[model samples]
Target: MSLATLWALGSVGDRLRVAYRLLSKDLDMQIETTAVIRNVQKGTASGDLTTHGLEFDQLDPAQQMAMKAFVFDRQDDALEWSHGAR
Candidate 1:
């Protein structure tokens, strides 16, 4: 299936799963990718993923949604990597 289709149809977890699967060819790639995702998830949960050390909760709702989309897209990009892209 195409990524756009998956992105349109899948939930966040599903997208992450597909991303990880695509990265599975390289152990380091998988580890690093998942680590970043985990950190973002942690920040989302605890409100700490800010450049100014402000809690994520302190951000306006639009900023919060932007952050989530940024993190999610980063994970999605993992699915597009090639050996040279690594």
Candidate 2:
């Protein structure tokens, strides 16, 4: 996964909007900050994702879908990774 993807995965909220400042280190990794969207709907709750000063195309499809699904389901523990052996 890319840094952008990691950042998106770490995001938590019904509606998510992120603004990332790409530093030199990020550029070294070929990561760029543009725009991201996360939309979710569950029961009587609905959320949206938006980013400022960023291009939407910068986000990966999987990351986008993951955000949407997470928001829609109102779940934040869907993809937890254990540090040690299971």
Candidate 3:
């Protein structure tokens, strides 16, 4: 199982559908999924946006693949950036 957490700068309902874009090669990739607000708290900021911990509740097969690709891509970037190795 994978964990999904989203910190919104605003209020989100208990359950909602969200669509977001990721860095896709040669194309704009947008993934949609349904999530539920599990917890809300303040982060390192002073603004109207309250951090909300979101848990992904539903995702189709295609969506899962896209998300996995996105996560892996991001992880690779982090590793390369941190280790100064491209």
Which candidate ranks first by TM-score, i.e. highest? Answer: 3
lDDT of each: 0.33, 0.36, 0.65
> What does candidate 2's lDDT look like per residue over 10-85, in tens digits?
2323323445432231121223334433432222323433222223545676556544554544333333333333
In terms of lDDT, the best-performing candidate is 3
RMSD of 3: 5.0
Output the better candidate (2/3) by lDDT: 3
Quote each prediction's TM-score: 0.30, 0.24, 0.65
Tens-place lDDT per residue, model 3, 1-86, is 22234445345456767777766553357767777767667556555445567778877787777778877877777897899665
Badly placed stretches (over 4 Å) of model 2 are 1-32, 36-55, 75-86
Model 2 clash pairs?
34-54, 34-55, 35-55, 38-49, 40-72, 41-72
Q: What clash pairs does model 1 have?
A: 47-56
For 52-81, candidate 1 gives per-residue lDDT tens digits of 111221444554455556566666667566
lDDT against true structure, model 1: 0.33
- Candidate 3 accuracy as TM-score: 0.65
At residue 18, candidate 1 shows an lDDT of 30
